[model samples]
Target: MVQFHKGFPLELGPVEAFRPNDIQHAAADFPELNFGIHHMGDPYVDETISIASRFDNIFLILPLWFNQYYLQPYKMLHRLGDALLFVGAERICYGSEAFIWPHVQTYIDTLATLQMPDELQDKWGYPEITREMRENILGKVFARGLGIDIEAKKRELAAA
Candidate 1:
């Protein structure tokens, strides 16, 4: 999985920033590998989304992006819409970026309260984020990317 942090090119400087072309080449060359771009490519969200749309193996990790946008509920709705419209919910995953933020509960609470605006719902043709989709983003999707069978793991834990 690819973890890119070039979204803040201006702050990090052009030299440190991740280039979209690099991602394109990697995705094209390694079609069989799952590519996960962290921070959702931050300031380059649109470009990341565009790149992800082209490669089925590409996934956007919602770590810093979630914390950054969750407070602004409207922006969250639009961001979610763009992701859903382009790559679908299955191609996205939630990331805590724990230790760095060090406040897991705050992030959890924020996500718990997130609500998609009615206008965005109408625009995206969905009433709201469903429980299944939420589960997928929070864990199932990432588990799948890593070739982990979450259901089987659950069964094993239950049997134990």
Candidate 2:
């Protein structure tokens, strides 16, 4: 579990915690290892994205942001859209948040029905969120990253 961001109480420390800058060195030093940044460095989303743009091995995980998505639907959707547009579906993954299972269901449902609005598409060149792209983000990409042959594994299990 990668804990890039924290909800640390800000009473004692003068400096902010969970800065993505702190993790940049490790990512730069270890190019072979893949990094799934939790919370996408929350409170520093843009910085995380900037760093991820530089490293191909960096992947963005989306489930932890469910609360933020519930609170700010459009803002979260746009942020996700930006990530999908910039990083491509191959570098994003989705899963349950454990605490908010129903919210996650809504999140998935929302994503399933997602479409790039015409104005946003024309203005920003954001691609339409096809079912295949969604599937890749949901699990296929992570399975590929882990070197898992999902279909073969399924067949093997079925044969057992």
Candidate 3:
């Protein structure tokens, strides 16, 4: 339930702060609840990444601002490396900070260097990105994570 933004940093300021300790407590009490963090929780990228690594119920979306593309490639790679190694490919999803900027594709393209998992990226990477990764990012993980019967549901909905 916390939304941490970088401009204000440590202090939540006007924004709500949802600490992991609190999240852990809530999950312990109500194990059925699903927790999701958005825009990598803005300025709390490192902390958010850490939480995703530790919690199975916690999911995150990577949007533009948190990508921090302006930083050098090595710095970007290092942070991205931590995310992939700790969070696992299935737990992470890609999203554009669309409407904030028109050329959001450039931001997503920066992931080129992370060399994400070969299974996540296409054979050659870049322009040739495949349907498998595309499906995973678009909705496969979400459907599987939520325990939805994707094929059966799709068929049922289509017939209705």
lDDT of each: 0.73, 0.70, 0.54
lDDT of 1 by residue, 1-160 (tens): 5555545454645643665546877888988888788766766778888988999988878876676564676776677778877888898887534427567778766655666678777776644677777787878888888878988999999999
The better-scoring model by lDDT among 1 and 3 is 1
Error of 2 at 42 (Å): 2.5
> Estimated TM-score per prediction?
0.83, 0.80, 0.59
In model 3, the runs with Cα more than 4 Å from the true position are 1-21, 70-72, 95-100, 103-134, 145-148, 157-160
Number of the top-ranking candidate, with lDDT as the measure? 1
What would the TM-score be for candidate 3 when compared with the true structure? 0.59
Query: Which regions of candidate 2 are displaced past 4 Å?
Result: 1-3, 6-15, 96-103
Ranked candidates, highest lDDT first? 1, 2, 3
lDDT of 3 by residue, 1-160 (tens): 2222222234545544633335545545655655555556545557777867777766565555444657655454455556655775565555322337577657555543234455433432322234564455555656665667799999999999
Q: 13 in model 1: Cα distance from truth in Å?
A: 2.1
| Model 1, TM vs. native | 0.83
